[model samples]
Target: MRALSPPVGLPMLAESDLVRQVARRLSDAIVQGRLAPGAKVAEAAVARELGISRAPVREAARLLESQGLLRACPRRGFFVRALSAADVDELYDLRLCVERHAAVAASRRLTAEARAALRRQLGLMRELAHRDDPARIVEADYQFHRLICETAGNSRLLRLFDGLASELRLVIGLIGRLYDDPHEIARTHEPVLEAIEAGRPERIVAHVDHHIGVAWREVARLARTLSPTPGGAA
Candidate 1:
């Protein structure tokens, strides 16, 4: 059982908050691969389809633009930003640093209640698997990792990875990989979780670092495939 972090609260939105609502919807779509890599975004069409004005949609596009999810084109609309090998490497490297430390710190604080909470998340993921819904599987995996981060008791670490997680979703999709392959991810995680629950901090770190290696290679592969040869970055 590990100590998991409590759920984060939503920040207060202004009285007039259409822009944020639009932004959040688009962000969720992008993260889930509903708006996948290299897809063109028609602002007017998205606005029409979503039944909102273009102003909010445009603002939403811009929000993702700064986050490296969308790229603006002159005299054209936005397109999903492709990840370069360098970009993927950088993203995963940061993930490794943050997750490694978080895993170690969290392992030291494992509690019985936390273990049950994680098992619940895993069961939910298994249930989502019955439908073969990749997106749901990915979302569940995100929550599962969030559970690990929560146990680390580091707010800043979770916040840092939160941003990375969205882009990482795109990376996973690019590789035609789901965030959690039930058996594979389970194998990788079970060892770490077991080690953590058993209070073997050293073995816990070993299992975690080993599991992260797969992600590192996947990102490296994606970075190379997304390089300037096909279509350069925007």
Candidate 2:
């Protein structure tokens, strides 16, 4: 039987941090492909590996279930959620809508502090890409877009973006190195930031649409490759 692989060099969790730490470790496993689609997440094995009790592991799985990373079964326990091409398509569709509007809003409301924050995030993405760390790069990529949503000055829009966070992370991880150079991923966002900085609503909308639309098409295509059957989860 395949065993759960504990994340290397992680310290033992303290009492207060058990559930969140377990959930984060499990989430890292899922996003990094250590836990594959539809694979059973054995609570016992995970607890053993993490040197924790079954209770925290169970609670962590439930948390991940709410995040759409795992689905619960009555007797069989939790399994990693399998995403279909349709799932990817739908997810990006929502992102395109949310981000396009958010970018337009951000362009109008661009503050000096917000601009610096976005630039800092972009720099971080470039550095992470240079180190060839895809997982962290994916995270930085999300933060770049998330910053746009936050700068939009709409609490509800930011909330909408937050809701899609985990599933977006999962799908991007599954897509795995969307660009060959990894630096290309960072490069693609340059125009979006430029458009925002320019404070042109039409330019912001166009760039945002193109950026997300490109990813949407690529992710959908790759998802279909990963799971061949029409609308079938894998």
Best by lDDT: 2
Per-residue alpha-carbon lDDT of model 1 for 1-234, expressed as tens digits?
A: 999986554532441277778776776676665775667778899899889779778887888787778888777778878776777778878877887788888877778888898788877766766666666666776777788899888898889878776676566444336344554544455666777677776787777787777777876775565433222254
lDDT of 2 by residue, 37-100 (tens): 7778899999999887898899889999999988887787888887777888889888888998
Q: Over all chains combined, what TM-score does candidate 2 have?
A: 0.88
The residue pairs that clash in candidate 1, if any, are 1-111, 2-110, 3-151, 5-150, 84-223, 85-223
RMSD of 1: 8.4
Q: Note the Cα lDDT for every prediction shown.
A: 0.71, 0.84
Q: State in Å the error of residue 21, model 1.
A: 4.1
